[model samples]
Target: MKNRIWIVCLACLWLVNNGVFSQEVSPRSVFSLNEGWECRPITTVSKKALFTPVTIPHTWNTSYSEGTILYDRKMMVYQRPLEITNAMKGKRLFLYFEGVNSAAQVFLNHRTIGEHLGGYTAFCFEITDQVKEGENLLEVWASNAYRTDILPISGDFNICGGIHRPCHLIVTGQDCISPLFYASPGVFIHQENISEKEAGIRVETHLSLKNKKEGLKLKTTVTDADNKVVANSETAVTDSIVKQPMLVNRPVLWDGKKNPYLYTVTVELYDGNQLKDRMVQRTGFRYFSADHEKGFFLNGKYLNLYGFCRHEDAKGKGSALLPEDYKMDMELIKESGATAMRLAHYPHAEPMYDLSDENGIILWTEIPMCGPGGQAFTGLVDTEGFKENARLAVKELVYQKFNHPSICFWGICNEILVSDGKKFVEYDDPIPFIKELNGLYKSIDASRLTALATCVDQSYYLGSSDLIAWNKYFGWYKDAAPSASKFFDDCKNTSKGIPVGVSEYGGGASVNHHQWPLAMEDRADSHFHPEEAQTFCHEGNWESFAKRPYLWAKFIWVFADFPSYMRQEGEVDGYNDKGLVTQDRKIKKDAFYFYKANWNLEPMVYITSRRFVKRDNPLTDIKVFTNLKEATLYINDEKIGTMKPDEMKRVIWKDIKLNEGRNTIRVEGKNGRGFLSDSCEWYYIGK
Candidate 1:
């Protein structure tokens, strides 16, 4: 009993010195304050409104149904009780907001701590002296109203208003890893001196000092994927920013769909051998670049980056996504055979980048500077407030996500020409601002290439960024049926050695609608925007991509249907049905199969236009997508024919006779391993 008491006392002393308690054993430095929060919209600030229980990964937008959902545009306050115990006496306390729509002001015990603008990025406030040893009141004022000073003042997607992300109460020793700069993972690991044999790993950590300034030891250790320590470095704290370089011999590169080798870097701060604070960062080493002549190259191997853009939103969660949601998204993306992603419009949750790193997915991440007209170029060319805010947003974006290896492009601004003064085609140039943003990006992160997404007219502001991407939907909107490569070919001629990419493309599709023989190229008038038409669009567009060598990346407009409150075009009420898959992701449209057939190295076959189950004509074309060399077709248990895939990886039996009532069609193919088959049932009612 006496020995047990001594052991307990020693353990208590050790934990006290480490600035951690029993409740925080899992997340030693961070405690998720996701539970026990009350929130309500604020009409009158006095006495505040009575609050209902809510969780952190929640949004008031979820309370409204499908078409009834309204963008509140009002300020809401969330209050919760935080327990600051006697154990956390000297440790610095930080209230970390993962995300809050538009703007937010944090208060600790009725005292204003700090305010952070821009809803996408994470930010924190130091609340050391503002709390008591017991329970304290923590309040956050969040709003999604139109802020002229914010980056995304106007956008197609609704800016959900609330603490629409996880918040954490971080406790750190006086000499721990700093969350000072935009609440980032203060430690950034840069992969340098790349080769097949050896690589130079540079670890940079920014530290925060409170009562104790010196006599601190910073140790950085890199562990391989197998949890084997590869390299370790320790140095005495001489400055706020510490740079420790480690040489990794025979480094395993992070190859896409091959081997996503990762190294976990653990940064620990110790005073006299007692652990003060610690932070674990997951990172990988790889080399990638986009070429003007040839497409993109990874690890010195040329490869085309084809994928889709994604929004950090779910069915009911708005943008208040969980780690599981992100994980599922990654799994879906992987299943779709996409090698890369464009996290369009805004910086997503941190776990997204981590998942991409683990799954070997390349990424093109950007800020929410989309759809042209904002305070920056709304009639007047430049507003001081807008410029400063834009700069700050870019700074936070680059600084916070600098360590992720999956990101290859830091997209500066997107489709600014929409708000280019008076006209969409011709207006005040936002190139200066673009250039300023690019410069700001380069000032902090020189590792990745910078880019801008343009939709209106690339000629007006294409010269600002290092690389440019076009969100052109020529066939769907105003132009003739694709010749999808036409615009890219024209741009490539005048690219002036600069790489060009197709950032956003493709038309909407209603899973509820279907067309016979696939809609024509110019199907814009097709109000329902049939699913087959969407499939045809993707097929033609990918054919163009296969023919062209200049288009560096091809990201479909979106991966899944997303909500656009003011949108009234597609079959869905308030949703943009441009996704290759349905909003719920329960259905993968034929367009999704077309890409998988061409891109995915997996063994599978799928029949197109299966949703067009009721055919009026007995003689109709049957189409199937397979990466297999050839496929055997059978109609109503009778072998029809055996054919090879065409230039588009499609096997089509044209004008096949269908039975009178129900027609059973089965297609079999040989993959790399063995036989793969797909079957669909169709009703042939004579017209």
Candidate 2:
């Protein structure tokens, strides 16, 4: 017993010498603070508000039902209780907001902590000094009101209000990786040089040390997909920043949709063998470039980038999307065999970038410095605050998403310049601002390319960025269906040696509306949107785009329908119906299969106008979109004729006689793989 007491005394002395019994702290503790919140709209500062329980991924602007869309462009207050336990007292704390619309000011225990401007990107605040021991009140004031100083002064899409994303509370040791650097991962793995033979990488780590102790070290390790350690380095953390160099031999490239290779980078902070913090970042090595005449090349191989534009707004959720929604969208996109996607007009959620990385889809992410469509021009303001906010937003976007390999183009602006201006055009030239944004992006990340989208034939803006694309809706708005093909010719003639692309095309389509003979007389804003006209417009536009390999990229207007408070077209009000898929993602328009047949390599067939079950003419054309070499049309179980697919993968049998009553239509297609057939029913009334 005496000997045991002596050993215990020695152990206590050793523990006291090492300071282990003083206070305990973990490496990093992160948890979602997405529940138990109360929100209330603030109409006026003097009026008292009634609070309602709400979730984090929420938007007050979206009308989930069939009522009028109440765009609540007002301030809202969200309050929740943040408990600080005794075990978490000594550690540093941080509050991270993945997204908050327009602007937000955070308060802890009725004291102002921090504020952030910009809706799309993320922001973080160090709350180590603000919290108490027990339950503490955390409040956020978010507003989506039109701010001249903020970006997206006016846009085609809705600016949703409230915290429309996830929130998290992060706890870490006094010396750990800093999440305050533009709300980034604080560890950036830079690919200095990459090739098949060797890859030179540099890992930069940003640190936050409250008690700067001597003998602090930073260790960076890189592991391949198989969890095999490829490279590692240990360096002394002299300052708040540490740089470690590594080299990988014969690195596997991240080929688009072919081999999406990834490498895991782990960064750990240590103080004399005691770990303080750890962070993990995923990275891939690939190089890409766009040739003015030869199109885009990825990793020294030619690749055709054909895909669709995407918006964050959905039917009921508006811009408040969950991870499952993102996954569903990616599954649909990948199923279509698309190689790229343009995140239109603004930066999307972080999960989207991750999905793009995982799915090997190239991305074009931009800021929401959108201009008015048509002849209006009120998107940009010529104020110092506005310019500064724009610049800050660009910086935040680049820094936060710097590590994603899927992002190839940093789109500066969208339609910032139109044909005519309602206000003073001299004050908003937008060329200088565009050039400044391009330069700023190059200054931060010169590895990627800069691009911008325009709506007019302003060749002067072509020199502003490395690549330029145009958003033209000639078939729908200009009353000329063939102009969709002619627009690319005009672009080719006046491209001035810069890589050009078609950023936005295709018109609105309502599945419930069908026209026998397609007509282009209907305007984009009209209530009568025929589904056949949209399919015809896409057919013409895609054919033209396919013929011109010089066009570096081609992105259809949108992949899925999204809510737009400014719209009242088609069957649905307050929504943009140009998506290949419906707003609720329940149906895919006929145009979706047109691209799938042209792009996908799988053996699949789809009969066009399947939703148009009633026919007015007894004699009609049976069009089928299939990847097979030849397809034969059948009516009432009788074969009509066999025809090969055109260059656009469309097989048509003209003047097929249909039965007067109920007619069963089927198309049997064949390629080298096998045979597949699609059937549909059409009721025909003899003319």
Across 491-523, the per-residue lDDT of candidate 2 in tens digits comes to 777888888888888899999988865657756
lDDT of 1: 0.81
TM-score of each: 0.92, 0.93
What tens-digit string does per-residue lDDT give for candidate 1 at 1-687? 999999999999988776665333322467889999998877765674578899987777653453474557889888999998888888888888888887898888888999999899999888888889999999999988877788786666777888988999898776678897778888888776777888797899898866565568798998888999889999998887889999988888888778888888999876655677788888778888888889899889987788999987788788888888888888889988898899978999889998988888899999887763322334223677777878888888888888888898998877676444555544445678788889889888887889888775666665688788888775677564366667788888787878989998898898778777654655444457888777777777888887876688989988989887656676755677888877677888888888888888887789987877888877788889988889999888899999999988999899888899998889998766779999989998888
Best by lDDT: 2
Q: lDDT of each model, Cα atoms only?
A: 0.81, 0.86
Cα misplacement distance, residue 291 of candidate 2 (Å):
0.8
- Give the best candidate by TM-score: 2
